[model samples]
Target: MRFCSRWVVRDQWHEVCLYEDYFLYRTRAADSTAPPEEHRVENGDIADIGVDREGPLWGITLTVTSGESRTVPCPATIAAPLLLRWHDRD
Candidate 1:
């Protein structure tokens, strides 16, 4: 599976991270060959997570802040009626 991600900074494109399985395949930024920022999530990191699923659509919350979050709707290529639960913080 391939996913496209765009990071915007100051109203401009900042960086992009491509994930293939559990590894990052490619990371690009506006002016540097390296990623704009490095994020290290712990082995069991779960913060501000939410889930949404309707009919044949499966959506997952990617980022959340102050109780507001963004959901990325997965295509039907992904299994439907899936359940996504937020892991409790340890």
Candidate 2:
């Protein structure tokens, strides 16, 4: 699943995606003059996952074992299932 937010004033788009085995985050700005920044983290390397409610969107934060952290915006439907599934594996 994927979700995006736009920063109009900065002309930037921020996005996050969760796949079966990885998480992806991306951002694009300035009319794509430069390449969009992307980050990927494997499921096995994720140390922790968390959620916070902000209206209808959930802020899903992933912390990696190597110390990088990212917060991805997602809906409740995707957030809860991901949390459950990840913990179940461990």
Candidate 3:
């Protein structure tokens, strides 16, 4: 499955594309005059996942196999199905 949403990266909002195995993101505020900053993260290294709901926002925390973790926020409406996918995996 694939999903497109807004994600916070380096204190800025960017358009992110999430897939089952990885995610891709690009800064939305960059001007066309300059190349947009892009990044990707592979899910294979993710060892644990957690979810938190704060009003309408959903915070997803992913822990890497190496013990690093980061939380990213997205709307609950979009996160519900994604969380379900993770649940089904287990």
The best candidate in terms of lDDT: 2
Worst 10 residues of 1 by lDDT: 81-90
Candidate 1, residue 50: CA error in Å?
Answer: 2.4
What order do candidates take by lDDT, descending? 2, 3, 1
TM-scores, one per candidate = 0.30, 0.56, 0.62
- What tens-digit string does per-residue lDDT give for candidate 1 at 23-55? 121223456655444442222332443456676
Model 3 Cα displacement at 41 (Å)? 2.6
Clashing pairs in 1: none
- Candidate structures ordered by TM-score, highest first: 3, 2, 1
Superior by lDDT: candidate 1 or candidate 3: 3
TM-score of 1: 0.30
Model 2 regions more than 4 Å off: 1-37
Model 3, poorest ten-residue lDDT window? 25-34
- The candidate scoring highest on TM-score is 3
